[model samples]
Target: MSQQRIGDRYELVEELSHGGMGDVWRGYDAVLDRPVAVKLVRQQSVTSPELAEEFAKRFRREARITARIQHSGVPQVYDAVLDDSLERLFLVMELVDGVPLSAYLRNGRPLPVAWAAAVVAQVATVLSYAHDVPAIHRDLKPGNILVARDGTVKVLDFGIAAILRTDVTKLTATGTPIGTYQYMAPEQVRGGRITPQTDLYALGCVLHELLSGRLLFTADSEYAIMFQHVNAAPQPLRELRADVPPPLEELVLHLLRKAPEARPADVQEVYERLRPYLPPPGSEPAPNEAGPDGVPDPTGLFRNPYAPRSRARAEQRPPAGEGQPAAQPVPAPVPGALREEIKEAYAHADALLDEERFAQAAEVLGGVVERAARALGPESRQVLELRTHRAAIQLLGGDYRSALPEFDSLADAYGRTAGPGSEQARACRAQAARCRAELGQVTEALAALEDLLALVRSVDGDVSEEAVELRRDIGMLLLAQGRTIESRHILEPLYDDLCVVFGPDDELTVEIAEALALIRLGLDASSP
Candidate 1:
């Protein structure tokens, strides 16, 4: 309801979708002044007081687990709140503006080879990260995957599926099957032990349908489809779609293998197999390539891949004498008359910044920076300060593409003027790394962070707040990259120090504690 508010902060704007677990609503966060998706738990799932309490705990656990997945392909979980009455459950998440994959699956023919492969490859990358969280998505269907306007494929309902797993297991009074029948793995139908392989099998079902433009196993009744999943052999992709490449077709069949172990070893292997079908960097996209609902080309990343992070790929920092950008000599100063003008411009920019006009503040500061560089000196601390403020404003404005190079240049400038290990240089490096992370250059971000962390520890010592914060950041970055063991190695000690320095009530301390708990959960799940 448009007039309804959940948790006294999120006002429901419009219902997005409704399923067994809950109704997803496009909501407005009044306090934050931003759009959010609010998933309200299905009232029927918590009809009794005892069941309501149980569901609340399950909801919180799953919400936290889902939030731990830091991939861009997974929507960020913002908050989970239960109403004072305990009659309602709400999960606030990033509002994804996209078209469900099911929209394209409705077409009567196969998608372009590159297009189909691109989607599957992205999904595989996401699965690799999800599996590391050790959270198996019980349901993987076209409906749960969305192709965002930017061509990023987002997997939805990771936690929601887990929440509803038990409820769906009870045989219905009518003997009707639950879940999307066409996408159900044979193991799922038989109520076998669900694992990461279960998701792979469902992915295979989805991939088959994408290539054939039809269900993997067609039947008139839901029960018939379930039976076919357990017994029927799928026809080869080429038989239905002659244009499907042999290698691609073979990969699809491998993913659809009847036994869990019979499938590819992991999503990584699935991605590698799909790589041959993906367009090479700088290659042209398929004709008429706009996806369903005017979504951007998903193949763009494959066609023009981000430059590899040299250091991270090598797993070693460059020697002191190598790989550094050449330094430039500072420019000579301009006339003294311009000094007052530059100061005035900076004042004006500061006023704009205080008003939250970040872009305009950056623009105002940019002129001051140029004039100050000329009137004072390019290497002057004043000039560097002006440039730094402008770069920070660009970042705050969400102009990441513009901010990244600025921060990089600022890092070099600060290093030259203030020494590489100076606080100013370290701050610039940290900001640049954050920019890289925001731009989806995770490897570069991690490498930059690690280098900065080492420098910070040498200058500030391990227990210094700066070093502690950098450690926390580095650990989170590692977690985001699915390097769970490395993340734990960094986070555990950082959390202990944070508790000692800032006390257990500190936000960063609490966050690191939660992260460590998630890491333990993954470890516990994998143990015998």
Candidate 2:
């Protein structure tokens, strides 16, 4: 329904996919001017009014809990709404672009050893972080894992199992489990206590299937599969596939252990066991390493280590000169000899920036800055502010290459003149961090924001808007990097503060709310 708008903001654009739980529509947030995914829980699926109420509570809980996961593989949730009629429930989330793992299984061919291992390792890493949140992904299957074009393995439906946990229970209303039959853990079949090991068992089953091109336990009936999961032994991997390594085979069997306690201790241990199969750092894989789809090797994170390496640094001097200048430099003459008032030009540029005409704003600021620099000195406060404004505009306009150096220079200048701890210096550093994020230097951006946030908190106190804004930026950046849990921890509280200080109508308040919603839906919409 192109004309249908949910929550007075999100206009449904196209139906992305549908499942037993609900329909997922690609939507546009009219207020924020961005794309979002709207998941509408089918009212008819509720079965009864009592179940409907419970479903709402569980949906809210799972959404909030999902937001707590800090891994980059988890999508960011944007918003959750329960219609007043309680007939329909909606989750607005970041829209992820990727192919489902189910696509790989279509050919029924066992994947390459490294490829299979790479996918599992990435899932395990995500689980390692998720397990720490103590949230069990009761259902983990090929359909729930997406391989982004960038070789990023994003785990979907993180808390959705819980959201629709009653879906199965309502069907039988007796004792059918919530998870899929093939991937269900033995403990899950027995209705035993769920724990982190439950997820590890599912991971093992997924890994086995990926390596063997078959389910671990297959039978004519679902009950038989459940029985096999609880009481039957899995077939040996090496026996089924000649290429499967002993260590890997052993690791899979260990993960498939019948007892929760018997399974590998945790996801961390599973990740380590898979480590040997991973490509070494800075490695160039053989022709076979790449998938038939030509998907970039997901193992590159292990092989090349995407972390930025330290560059040798030479001693640097102050950007504002040896000392702070007491006076402004004289204005430079334009080719046409056109003279414009600096304040008027700044006002016009600011208006443009507010309207989101970032390039135009930066251009205007640039000329003013040049004239201001020549009229005043290069180190003049007015010139410095103008440069800062231009850098920020460029950054907002998505020109990271230009913004990065400008912010970097501004930071040094502010540091030299106002002291590193000064408000202006910290603000410039914060802008630089934003530039890093825009440039795809996620780790560097996070480190920079963390440092700046700490400095701002110490200097301006915790309640200051500067400190609060820094926290918001840090949360958004973490979400960008797929650290949902950490972002949730920061944004949840920051949102509350913003609401109290600036009210729910404030722009920052709405933004934080949107961010939390994105984290819930396993999406990252934090790009220019």
Candidate 3:
């Protein structure tokens, strides 16, 4: 059989593992020329077409949110792919060279106290960063944790649980909960709200199993295991292993508390509690203090925090920009096949936009923009238009970080191709400013908009649509910044212009009038 390809870029090499949600493959990225782990999730039994669409939206949203987490412990998400039918989903991620924590549990032998503590400490640090992103790992378990060759603990599937839980009963058609029974928090078993504490409870279960060589709770059936988690009291680690430290046992109990509120306040607190067990900075392990056979020492990080790579390893590292796919040189004239591909890409992107799939639309356009730029010259109108459309779609999808730079680049390109005073240039500049405002850089955004508003007025006059929109944006930004007087100064005149140009009953005119009325009420009330 021919090799399976995803998004026409990732080529599956072999199956790695299979789980309830999907099958993971060892894949190769044809574009980047690197190894990637591709998770193929097949949803074949959707009850209705409407439900499938909702699932696709939630899956894409959660995947984007998960990618926002910047940390070494969580594998970087490279891409998310959904087929036209929205049934076969693919998540391409950084392929980790590591062994799952479950491998160490094969012989039912407990790990050394320091080794187990080191692993959990690393996981806790990663969780602290993830929770700050507010991306909770609702299904954290041993199988999802990997110990890399360098002993770094990588946590997998950051947003997969939330994606599955979007409409669990309806999507799964089973009315079953969405976490591992043995490691699930009591609230999860009870169908209560999940929070960061839910992950902490799972962490406690992992630590207990690592130290005791057995699960925290066990039964023949999944329901029985869940029952033990919800209502049964846990046996203290000390009772199972006399070698367990008193404080460590106490910490485990605290994390596995029945109530979410009763667990440690957050992973940060848990990290602090485990610090006593971690190797101190600049310290070296004793001659006999080695970890399990074939397993790297987890304490190496604490012993030499942020150490530089060895000279040999550094020599093997690729220089910046090496190994990345380079754009093909453009021929004297663009090929017919390439032009056809560009046209098809644009048509597909427009259709996706009609369906309100903003992110996917942006992706579809992005897939062709690079090739179009190389073939048609970077400054060609076609390339510029494609970039502008993709940036607008990104802005609509709430990806201001990605949109801001694209808009800025498009503004400069439009000015070079069309003129500094061109409407297209001014519009791109305004969009960039709006992106800045969305990103909370209000002061800079206001300054840019004000300057652009002046430019718009000079070129198109004060009542032009561009000038009117800029004025409205500036007024609202000032109002948000608590500068009511300044906001009124800008909006009061613009409201009159809207009424004169489009009538008082026009949607834009009425919206401005309502805003002015609210500002008046505030000023009148504050006079006392």
Worst 10 residues of 2 by lDDT: 312-321
* lDDT tens digits by residue: candidate 3, 118-155: 99999999999999988999999999999988788999
TM-score of each: 0.57, 0.58, 0.58
State the TM-score for model 3: 0.58
Relative to the unseen true structure, what is the C-alpha lDDT of residue 398 in candidate 3, on a scale of 0 to 100? 86
Off by over 4 Å in 1: 167-178, 286-293, 307-528
Q: Which candidate order results from sorting by TM-score in descending order?
A: 3, 2, 1
Q: CA shift at 84, candidate 1, in angstroms?
A: 3.9
Error of 1 at 129 (Å): 0.7
Q: How do the residues 239-301 of candidate 2 rate in per-residue lDDT, one tens digit apiece?
A: 899889899999999999988998888888888888888888777888866665645456666
Q: lDDT-based ranking, best first?
A: 3, 1, 2
| lDDT score, candidate 3, position 127 | 94
Q: lDDT scores for all predictions? A: 0.78, 0.78, 0.84
Q: Each candidate's root-mean-square deviation in Å? A: 16.9, 18.1, 15.0
1-528 per-residue lDDT for model 1 (tens digits): 014888777768678898766789987665655668998875555667888788778878988988988899999999998887777778899999888888886766667777888888999899888899977777789889998876779998887766655535422224333356787777777766788888898889888888888889877877787778888888999998888889888988888888898999999999989988888988776565545545566787777678443232222223222343436556555556676766777787677567666765576677567767756777776788888888888889788877877776776666666556667777877887888898888997888788877777777789987788778888988898889999999999898888898899999899999999999998899999
Judging by lDDT, tell me the better candidate of 1 and 3.
3
